[model samples]
Target: MAESQLLCMEDGLMPTAVPESRPQFYYSEQHRAALERLITGGDGAFKSLLKDENGQDFLSAREITAITSSFVKYKTDEENGGASAGQDKRDDAGSLHSTYWPQMSDTEVPPLDIGWPSSGLFKGVTRVAVHTHPPKDNGPHIKEVVRKLIQESSKVVAIVMDLLTDLQILRDLFEASKRGVPIYIVLDEPGAPHFLDMCNRLQVGARDLQNIRTRTVKGIGLNLSVGRIPGNVQSKYMLIDGDKVMFGTYSFSWSSSRMDRNMITVMSGQVVDFYDNDFRELYAISDKLDLFKQFHMTKPQTGTLSRAAVPKRPAAATSRFQVNLGDVTRGDGKVPAHKYHNPKYLLALGQIPGPTEPLQDFFNKMEPPDPETEQELENPTEELENLTPDPSPPEKKKSKKLKLSFKSKRGKKDKKSDEVIEENPANPSDEASKHTLTRDETQDSLKKKNTECMCVIA
Candidate 1:
């Protein structure tokens, strides 16, 4: 199921002779067993990822909203002294429970209604927070709401990153740690090549602050998928301390802060315990450990400054439009064939390297024909026909329009027309003379020998 998380560059559009080889990756059985055991045992670490029994390692957007709202509601209720039991609960009951306590002792108390509330679970959570450093100043309400959690308690401060450095945020977090406040940093994985330099820079910051716990994303599997069915799944998220997490399109950098529109949600408590475990697992294999420890001592790689600045425009976001086997087979469990209809994406697939091709360069090489150059290549068919010989006649039925001569009119005029005339001349007298004359003489001869006219055009 974890294998389904791979991004399939092959959409079954390429020729059948060449099969696209998927990226080879190995999953740690130890990790899988650990995850399963943790969840089954109701360990706090299990909740960090917010996955189901199927191992789908993501919470939907609605789930995120619900979880944050649950924390908010619980905190609000706690403030009003109605966190658990209300004194007015008996008012709604028609029967007087106080007098019926003796009868209730003999009877079961309706088993306490073990159903999940529409409001969802709201226990073991004290605050909600959100943070982002998007390219724009939009989504202020989300930021403010998350900040409210911080103002409510000194122990809990939901840091919503409006416009700040990710490294600086971590530095401040280290300060908060000394003061005994738990902090978490959430940001996207810097996957694209364009962001590698920025990441290298932030990693320098990670190196500077030895006191603070810092991690840079090494890899994300989204590997919580079911079986080996490749499909479009999650790609962006980071959780800090189970309580402070960020999930969205933005990454941890100046570009993500100033150029991309993004969102983050922070909810603390058991939820953090759940999300934090998933994060720590991925972070363990990442280079961030080295980066955070080294800080300013390390300079950007040789090409970081030499390369051109990344354009401020958001990269063209791509979406996968997968054709599900289930839909075509109708629960038959057969792998249904699908066509890659998107021309742009299909072209991208062709460029990706399999075992034979380096996938990254293949995609990068995909170029759309320039409209101007395409127009220049367009020439009329008549011009081409005039330049080359006509197609050979069909053996069964030859074309009536087939030309007998390859040369132009002037070149073939005398020999071909004269030969035709020799075979079937308009006048026998003109044939006998054979010698051509000037205009008047030719006119007189033509008038004298005007028996018939057999010009091809006529």
Candidate 2:
């Protein structure tokens, strides 16, 4: 009978023998106590359940809520004689109470509720995660997020950005392209060159060339007929397989990671649909240049000059002289000549003619030297010495003078000369006159000498 009742429950049919009292659907004290402990433990208990056997935390919010609902349904099923009914022939009330309110140690509690919607907007997606830059939580770095998206994507990868200067991200995209994954990129016109260069590098040895396609948007396609001026498409976002999206103010540039203060969120499910749609719209108006054809096109011969072929110089006029030849001369008697004329023949062969007579005369009349120049002439020797280098060596030695001495052996000859000189000293008046001259006589002698010297100079 219990087996039949269990089969009926599985088939979604009510059993024939109903309980006298309505079975309680609410939690017992033991169940409530176990749930309280799980919640109080914060995310520790929840994390254990969310993590897979490999320890990867891939549980979504909706999956967590589903786990909680399953636990409640399982307890209710046992009360309806579901799980232990085939074991033994036990009293109904005792079995039902044991099944509905089991000991906390015996019954395992569910993990914390993740509070995710099970089925709403996006279909087929079972997981969704959000991360911010300058991160609020210990989430994956933006670069890692990008790499994972490209690595896990199966069908297509779409990216839209105003700037993309990150080399690592570019390499990831290149790698994805090599895997034959279709990649669509919409970038600002200025950044289009960078992305295209990366694509070109990947295509070098590739057999399938259509895996990557790129288009350039002008200011993120925001310029609405203001004469086609490039606009600022400042958005930075990427969509993976039309199901996952990673977006924020964080740009796909090196500086954006290390220098700029920005944010990015990695998420999946319904929200991704909106971003994917936006990416497609932006890509539609993008400037789609065929990179394969452009890079492979036959280039013009580079070594040769590109100038147009020279036209044969018009045949020289048959006759040198013409009726209108004189008309070409100007009023000053100057005739127009061909551009090929030698410049040497343009002017007279001799020295240029001087100024007219009155002008020449005016220049010839000399002006006095400036006062400064006249002062400089006052000390011409010093000025000349200053101008020229001295011939004397800087460190020349002085010559010594020779000293002469008379010896005592010549005493007799010296005494004889002294005696002759002493005799004049014996005559006092003659001695005095020989030693001294009067002041008036000295003056008269000096005047006579000056007059004689003057006559010689004249």
- Global lDDT scores for all candidate models: 0.38, 0.52
Best by TM-score: 2
- Point out the worst 10-residue segment of candidate 2 by lDDT: 416-425
Give the Cα-based TM-score of candidate 2 against the true structure: 0.35
TM-score of each: 0.26, 0.35
Model 1 lDDT tens row, 1-458: 34422323347543222222434434434345544444344345555533443454444556434433322111343467663344345545554545433633453322111111121244375476455544135545433433333333334222222222445443444455445554433223333233234445544343233323333443233232221111222434444322455455544444555566667665655565545445444434433333332334543332344776886632322223443333333432222112233455445443321234344555476666444323431235522333333456466232222232233334455543221111212343463554433334533533332333222331
Which tens-of-lDDT digit does each residue in 134-253 have in candidate 2? Answer: 556677776677778888877777788877767777777767767867777778877777766755665543333446666777652111111112245787888776667788888787
lDDT of 2: 0.52
After aligning candidate 2 to the native by TM-score, how far in Å is the CA of 210 from where it should be? Answer: 3.3
Highest lDDT, which number? Answer: 2
For candidate 1, the per-residue lDDT at 301 reads 39
Badly placed stretches (over 4 Å) of model 2 are 1-128, 197-209, 220-228, 297-458
